[model samples]
Target: MSRRSRPRGAATAAAERRASSRALPQLELGRPTSRYGRWRAATLVLVYVLMGIHIAHWRIRGRTLAPLELNEVMYTLELGVVTAGFLFMATVCIATLLFGRFFCGWACHILALEDLCAWLLKKIRVRPKPVRSRLLLLVPPLAMFYMFLWPQVLRMLEGRPLPTLHLRSDEQGWASFQTTDFWRNLPGPGIAILTFAICGFAIVYVLGSRSFCTYVCPYGSVFRGLDRLSPGRIIAVGDCTACGACTAVCPSHVVVHEELQRYGTVVNPACLKDLECVAACPTGVVRYGVGRPPLLRGWAAWKPIRRPFDFTWGEEVWLALVTLGVLLAFRGLYDAAPFLMTLGLGVIVAYLGLCVLRTAYQRDVRIGPGWLRRAGRVTRFGVAAYAFAAAFVVFWGHSGYIRYHEFAGHRAAAEAVALAERALRAPGGETGGEPHDPGAVPGLPDPTSPTASSGDPMDEPNIVNRSASRAISHLEQCARWGLLRPPRLSDTLRRLYTLRAEARVALSDLRGAIADLERVLRLDPGAAGVHYNLGVLCATSGRDEDAVRHYSHAAALNPTDPDVFNNLGFVHLRRRAWGDAERSLRRALELQPSHALAHFNLARVLAASGRPADAARHLAAAEQLDPRLAQPADPAATP
Candidate 1:
């Protein structure tokens, strides 16, 4: 007989086995226990909450935190970028790293609702052991058949337009409706409800336990790769005792026990830390630990219960069916709020109907384990409730385009005006242009005032400052007339400027008009029409600060005219200066207020300073008054 080779460690192994049998050893899987059962619940709620906040930021809903397109900037967070941007791509990457498809588990609101749908559906699908039998097994395949045949079933979107859904939300045909901009401008409460009902159903049945992860999802492969470095992993130990509890609970269908022979101990990427294996390990061998191989993490090492995945098949079938319905039916309904609401109501009623069917089935059949059946029924029922919740949450994709959804900004005329304004203000000031009479241009309306009170008529300040006056005048003119689709401001300026003179003389109390005319003058002094308008406005309004700027601008821009110089003198005379008043009145007589009456006023100023003889001479000559200057001699030097 061949001598049997005995391993050197046999004696020690036997002794250790005997010692192990004497007392149950304390084993630990993970240092901490994180139950996965509640994770799905928490995750489902978070997505809906996030959706709700997004909807509140719309303009049509009667709120506006900012409007960047007005050419009127309130402020900017950055020199060229808006704030509140989303990091969707980044979140996808993070989800890839943990548990392989956790976004489906954690962030996907649809999936959360689906979990409930599965439970409810199970109640309806309830019966004996048909899940693996021909009766129950056909559901998964039959579902695939229906989904593939009618690819348009995924119509349950939060806010697709009615036209897109092939329903007439408005007068337009479906194609025409799509051509319109319903997607970008609208939101309603109905879409939210629809999303909840359909997505809820998908999570309840079909794929069963990690259904989205196993079939339909392409992202699963990506996640599978990333979870290779998951801090928690599943492993098989020599002490496993050949028990099979881990396989029963696994939602993802990863063979947890097979790792013993394949990988030195056992660690496949399939483990999701669901903790079923730890409880099922009768000898407490299968465990989770950090670093090195053969370490598992979850609740198993410290407790009991065969850890089978809460996996079921209601999920995939449901997703396939609901996604199909939403994609098709939910399309064009978004345009009208009422239509969307009606469609949402229809979906809610349908969900209830399905719920009734499922409940009857569950009560009749004793097919699955108590927990699974309950989960199936409960999950499916959640579909309707979730729809209502989501309807409230999405508000019809209201926040989808927020934070930087601006279209390409290339409107030519607006650009030109903005560019010109930007160029002149950076210190050097003037953008020189050859002279041209705008009044001669065709199609250009003769400028007029919106109100009687317009431009300044007071102040004889340095109007002769040629360069500054010319530059400012040109810009002002451009601002009033250059921008296409000009806002109401230009016309209003013209109105005030047109009536400036009367505004000054009558104490018209049109002080605001004079102020506006002054701003226009600052922007464009060479604008004779505006200057003419301003001088008239100020002389009447008694807005002296403004009156001076406009009068001087008009006087300088059209200096060849004696009427302007004469007007200038009268304004100075009104301020009660003696010699200066005389000089201005003299220039007016020389340039010509021709007997425009400024000289008559000037004599008063000179006389106030005690030039009695000069005052008497002018007073006697002015008795031949133009008569038109009678009613409002502007009593005293209020200027």
Candidate 2:
């Protein structure tokens, strides 16, 4: 059976050449057909219909089965929420152990999306050339580590314990099984659309069909590992013809004939077992069969691991750097892009980046249907691509700038807060009372000015002198950028303003702090914490009327907070509004019976109103709760 003597239909020269080049070659024995396509298509359609009904049930009934998303594996690992997705993934893994990787071929929505995109491109006669790189193949497994293992690693580093595993119902909110908020774990509408566009369509068009499964899907990496132990496989059941038609029809781009010839079975983890090859085999040789798993096959199993990569060493390095840059630039861009979408975007950008570089340096380059460079000259198509890439680079640069400022501001603010906390906790610094009491105003040595130092570097006053200046500067820059671009950093403006207020408070600038808090309210009028902080600042500044107003607003926003009611009571007591003062203090005690501050304040209100008996009882309770609230050594001193 010499090559020339074998049947021409068995292995055409063109088919052999295409197979060697790792491209989809036309079959000599007519176009290869898929027996499983219609069934898989119908199954995918039914899956989608069921998904719609699930969403509808949640909408109409207000609670339903939790979303069967694979990513809920994160919740199971990090928070110990045993979600439906966690159970679903466990079921699939068990099934894969017995029957191989059929879920991906027949059930995955993303796979359906890639297939549809490929079919549409075929209609237009556009065959995408798949780009293969060894470095790019590391992405999925690396992503799997980040998704499932990194959080636990961080928790260990931070000396945190694992969360307790528990089930929850809808009434508890954000539950695992029956969730009222169906979209809580899902991405926003904009992100969902972008995910579909990039992962489903763009990656397929740019890097060939099923590119997402190969280069970006973290879940696929898990399944691929599990597939190594699966006994179910596509094995040769009959004759010895190698026409390469099975490879031509494989949507996953697996070289079916090569694997079969080397291992006597489809051992590639990339094989989805869609059975396209079974239908395409002219001799009826390929079929499903039980066999020893790869693990049990010993050293002989390693023979089929000689697939050639598409890039040289230098080009691989370039692809790695470009892809990493694109991933960092696009991930969480404008606080919207999700990690998976960014990974797909990275692959596309890396491909285009290489094409652009080739257009400039290499000869006879073509992308899609257009010649980018030919005969060492740049064509009009090359210029157009260059223009588009240039615009994209500009956009990337701006996004980088915004991210830098946001990150820097947050880092500086964190340092400032740590410094201020250290100073407040220093020996001879503000102490006596509970540091966390929201209703208590600081009685500083100099209420009207920043603390004066005795020219000692180690002095607490000197330590906090410039603690927040740098933080304020960075935050101001970030805020300015956010202001110029509405909705760019709009979601973070409230947080920025709140942090700035804390920084101002550290500097002993109560007015500046109040102004920043007012800005926070403008951003988020319902923020109870901001209102409470503003009330404290106003009380320290002797603006009793404004303090009462802010405390009232805080109380309305968060009725469960006893601190707000206590603070409002104190302000009313200062203004000599006895009835109002007593009511607020009593409400505070109702929320928290052990609130010493509220008891102390209530006593003051009762004493001012001449209810001596009631005042004495509350005073006794306050003194019992906190002995510091008792009368000082000097009889003239009032608590």
Candidate 3:
């Protein structure tokens, strides 16, 4: 009976070998054509064009389209409002639920940038190997929570009221095409370029093309979760020989062959639905279609192929703790560094720390050579590591120094603006007084004169000029240090110029004020407020033609602003264009019925046009709105 059983087993083994040999030939498959590559490129181009259009519309028409950032939505959610960004994110989430991360595969701008990096790496014949670790996967979810959920949760815990749900349309939309303000929205060019290199290119060069998507992007976590319940999936049909061709071409490192063999579908969330696997399959068995839910297969569906470097549960726990701790430790550095740079720095530090601990542990255990040899090896490694770390520290310190100067400059500029505002509101003392020394303290009354209590309408003591000088000094220092170019700090420079202009106006330096205002206009060409200010300055200097042009521009940019219309009418009245003045004054009154200045200005225009009855009615309305208009003009207040 034993002989019969042995013979039967040998016969069955022989039959299995024969069947396997006959079923599929050992065909060595080459690289498959990237069928979706063109589609991805097209989609990326289209998205970019749309973004450009959005920026153009904002710059040209002074209106906002929807924002394109998922982080914007997260920010709005924290504020408990549904902005255009939120609506856009909702649309993406719904589409992901239906089609399974198609945006990540085809439309993401960052993904396109990363893919371009990958293509360049391929040109240099450098193919990166993927580091597969389940522990690393936790980062995206943690980041998602940190960015989108934690702020609101903390607010709730602090007993803060949930903000009302509303769209945030107050500011010009998220991204700008205006070169000056556009750079302000991003990290400084230096830091931005570094981020693209380290997070996008360097990461992909070392840890594979999809490494950032897999381990860092918070938005990817949302899409990954939605993809699990998606109906669209790649399923196996017909003859599948378990050939590894499909797996070889997967940029995301998905075990396509094993997944197909086990569950007859690609159930891995990392599968980007790139369709390279389907194109690479020799048997033509893999195709995208509706399939049974992978979850129905239970535990068997998730059995993963373990690699040699796969982390044990203990190691995973340790790594996770270390990563979280490092992330918290470096949170304050985010303003100095871009988000991706911060994440990459945290990862590097955590990895290095873990390496040190691991080396020490191995040394203590005598895992390799004798104590002396191990100690020598460790010393060599420590020296190399220390050198790299020291260089990194120096670079970090330099960056911190730059950020410090930027902060100091911004603070000084803010103080200058506050001082200027106070000087503007302060009561003017005696007119035709000697100019105070530039070094004298502002907001102080002159001690030598009996009429010192009466403030100068033109700030004749030079208080605003002194404050603006201090601001200009700080701004110049910032510019010298190259801190003024950062988008975050550009507005400070603009404010500095504006403060300088106001100071010039108070000093009766009309030409200098005009030059400063022109600089401000160049920096923000679409600023309606700046246009209005320029119009006022031009009018004060008797440049009636320039004032008319500037006021017309201000009105066009902000048609709803009654001040703009009123100012435009005032400029027209100075030019003695009765028709234009009357029309603009009526429009201003239409916008705001209680505008006394508009009523008085209209009365003057009506009187100039020989309409005594109309002029009398408007004069009465002006007097009722503001009785001060009925009083005789004070000689001291005249510019």
Candidate 4:
């Protein structure tokens, strides 16, 4: 998979994709789109242009995209903080979901670093590196650690949005756009740039291929599924003639020929469709097409297509992995045999599996709907899904950090949103056969509905009961994944916490949930959702005083969360503090009048606290608002 192990036949097709890659007796590069680097270059300019807008807002405007930010957009799936640079973040996600990783291929800062590293690697001769066994062991853990921590860091973070980076703002390259005192220091940026350059060079050549995209770059991970789900993709048109050109040219080390035979598209997330494979096809069979190809002929040439990525993938970050492997090997030589053997087996299996899968899956003919040539409504649906995911990523990824950083009136801004969105939030019970204004943005067709907001969201084919149930199930699974861990003291502790807290409220042992969450907070106190969870836990425990404290913190963290206010009010009601209870409940009602509980509780508190006229008014109001709420709070009769 290291691009070198590729059968040495594809060099020619790649010559045309990158003008510079074609340069040589040295190293042949990109394919047909080489000329398009003009626009690609322009894209980088445009990204910086957006970055300029972000800087301008931060400095002259003294504001950034709050509403457009991700967490503000989608807290349902707390992916991460979305950049406060709403326009930039929005563009990155929407455009990417729509157009592929044109941003990364053309303008990503990390991609630039990779390019520099590749250039340096070419300047000298070195063997490609191997992946380290130990890193794999740690990655799953690290990934899990970050997942739990992110929501909390999101809760604790001051603000500015994240999954964002410091804009490298020089005339020639990315520079620091943040004007804050923290970014004034040059060391971190300097080290980062240096690290990128070294890794890029090592990865492209000696350290393995496409290392940056596979291992180091965060943006690449974001765009992988986007590219896979996209309707159009670059593909090998016909027989590859067994040329190695495409493989050699791919920075991500993708097999151009294999893509032509399999899914019939370069659905591989790493594929940017630079089209080196088509250019490398000496047999003149390779061509880019819409769907999977019709004629799947050519196993001789099919070997290239059949080669699975399981092999060279670690090479995507092979160099760092190799370094880590060496370290691990050295350490393992003296340590546990089971651990070392497991690690070794994993590495061996990955590489060997890639080789075997490619050979095993190599097909002589293409598969799938032959008529999928045109982009249809499903494609539009795909586009919408991409946009939704992208928008969420951009917003959630960075929003919390903005809150954590605490800019001028940020806390106030959040509270305002919580009061607005939550107080008016539908509370899941809608009666009038679904509201008309479907909340679809004007001009953009709702992938599910051609009409504007008139259609019932639930009635829509995509959002119908079955699909919604499936979606809810999927989300629940994801949330539950937060608790998985090999048994340990931590696991036991988590179980204990859930036994005491989450179980009592939701009738489930949620101590694991708390343990998992607390672990996250330990890593990133500035995260957005941590305080919110703590508040919920406190409320269920009848610790109103503590609940209020956590609720306020949660409110401070994400003003957009409506449930926070509802709970805050509930805590106040539990304390029997009528005035504060009324205020909290009223605020919750304003945000979401459909909330039967808020109305019921407000009415109950009013009646109990010596106000006949007011109590009668509330009693009438609660029944009208929710007839179910007219009943008393008997455990059996409770909502």
Which sections of candidate 4 miss by over 4 Å? 1-33, 37-42, 45-99, 123-145, 148-206, 278-289, 292-639
Per-prediction TM-score to the true structure, in the order listed: 0.30, 0.75, 0.55, 0.35
Q: CA lDDT, every prediction?
A: 0.40, 0.75, 0.65, 0.44
Superposed Cα deviation of residue 385, candidate 4 (Å): 49
Highest-TM-score candidate: 2
Question: For model 1, how does the per-residue alpha-carbon lDDT over 1-639 read when each residue is reduced to its tens digit?
Answer: 111332324334445545633433322323222355565566567767755554444424543322212111111111222211112433554754543434545665545664565545545663121111112223333333342322333323434322221222123421211123223323334555654443344333433444433332333344444565454355555556544445534444445554533452335543555555556566767775533322243332212122222212343244334433432333332222222223223333333333333433342212133221242354443445456546743532332221011111112223333433332222211111111111111111112323222334332111111222333343344344332223333443343333332223222334544464556665455676566555544544454455556657776787765545555555565555556656756776766534536546655665676666876566555544444333234223233
Task: State the lDDT of candidate 4 residue by residue for 32-92, as single tens digits.
Answer: 3444544555665676687567656766655333322222222222433332333455677
TM-score of 2: 0.75
| lDDT of model 4, residue 159 | 66
Q: State the lDDT at 26 in candidate 3.
A: 32
Look at candidate 3 and give me any clashing residue pairs.
184-487, 428-455, 428-456, 429-454, 429-455, 429-456
Model 2 lDDT per residue over 3-110, tens place:
454344324533654677664455332343355777888888888899899999988998889999999889888888888999999999888888899999889988
Best model per lDDT? 2
TM-score winner between 2 and 4, please give it: 2
> Which pairs clash inside model 2?
none
By TM-score: ranked, best first: 2, 3, 4, 1
Candidate scoring better on TM-score of 1 and 3: 3
Q: Which ten-residue region of model 1 has the weakest summed lDDT?
A: 431-440
